[model samples]
Target: MVVARTRTTCVLGALLGGALLVSGCGDDSSDDAFSGQKADDIAAKAVAATDKASSVHMKGTAKVKGASTVGLDIRVDDQGNCTGTISGDGARAQLLRSKGGDVLIKGDRAFWTNSARAGGGDAKQGEQLAGKLAGKWVTAPADGPDAAFCDKKRFLASMDQDKTERQGMKRGTETEVDGEDALTLEKEQEGNRISMHVATEGEPYILKAATAGSEDSTMTFDDYGEKVKVQPPSQDEIVDPADTQA
Candidate 1:
């Protein structure tokens, strides 16, 4: 859950900003299916479709408040299974969440060292913890703080509509996202420009959301309804925190 707050602000804010803007017509209109539709309507449809998705793969880069850019590549399902990699602050880790709510993380040396120091350990202790935990799958209980990153429910809830943010919105020129036909929606708020691309040929799911100015961010969504497959790490690869003195 390292980038959880940042992800919510960057990704969910893009979604809400795009959805909240007042509807307007675009400059050019072709015979595309969504050309005649209202921007708000299209945005609403996209939001609804995304809300109903059984699963999705999200990839993006966002700046954390006290950290440099963070990168995410996560595939998660409604059943709470997820697998992904998170990289930030010169550290990277692979994470897996089982359907039964278990979370396992295998991080590089830098990641372990950073975590150790962040938890108030001294340099020597950080290095020792890294030596023992680096590249080892560490199990986290379902109710633990680490499990917050694996909660698909919280992820989606961040995108829920916020009426107060609604302002002026307009449709942009039709575009393509990841080889799929999409309609662009644009909005601006507090010096930030927000854009959302919604698929036009299918279920109108939001394919991408981007924000620029002050803080730049981008999140893309795909693999709708795909199954999230994950398995717990073997005992040999797992490092229980209770067993570690660090």
Candidate 2:
């Protein structure tokens, strides 16, 4: 049950507070309204900027509910390799060791060998269990600021499917995240509300996201549009001999 999660951007509450403040009036209302509107605009720009950059690099934490999620951390490479660890509860740790169909997930006690040739009850059981867990994962352009994930563009462009109305809150003014000025956008959907912070310098942009729905997940972006060094995974990181039978 290795859940294949499509990567997403960061939407920090702090950043969204400022951008969501522009849509109202009065001393506090005015401030809040302006923040919301500004955040929307900033997020859009950040997406555009991040799209334009040659690469991006980032890291963050995620908390998920409904499914088993204690803490999960992952990284993506421009060449299409997504690798990381999942630790908590009885499972301990799970590692993503490949891209797409070649993927592998190793739990602290056992591992999944994802080759098409592998077959068995444990394999099927592992896949089913992994699929039921809910948690957040981080993503950035594999190449740093100058590059972007090709699939990501399509995902963000399709925000209509999951659009939710925003909850009524006092939107804060635009603010800086880690150093970059960002605007945040907040909207409610289903039982959860999402806030996003967007910013950009040309194609190198930053977008952060936070959700308060059934699951709590937060993600951040850094050097999204700037090209940064990405190292190749060592051979050992790609496969586990213990999971493979000779």
Task: Give the whole-model CA lDDT for all candidates, comma-separated.
Answer: 0.67, 0.37
Deviation in Å, model 2, residue 66 alpha carbon: 2.3
Residues forming the 10-long window of minimal summed lDDT in candidate 2: 13-22
RMSD of each: 5.8, 10.5
Best candidate (score: lDDT): 1
Runs in model 1 deviating more than 4 A are 1-37, 159-166
How well is each residue in 1-246 modelled by candidate 2, as lDDT tens digits? 001133322211101111111111112324432343444444444555554444444344444433333443444444344444444333333333233223343433222212111233356554543343212121222333211222234323332222222223223456667877654455554575556655533342545656666656655656553333324345555543333332
TM-score (C-alpha) between model 1 and the true structure: 0.80
lDDT of 1 by residue, 137-225 (tens): 88877665565456766665545535333335577767888899887777776687778788888698878877777657788889999
| TM-score (C-alpha) between model 2 and the true structure | 0.49
Task: Indicate the worst ten consecutive residues by lDDT in candidate 1.
Answer: 11-20
Q: Which clashing pairs does model 1 show? A: 21-169, 22-168, 22-169
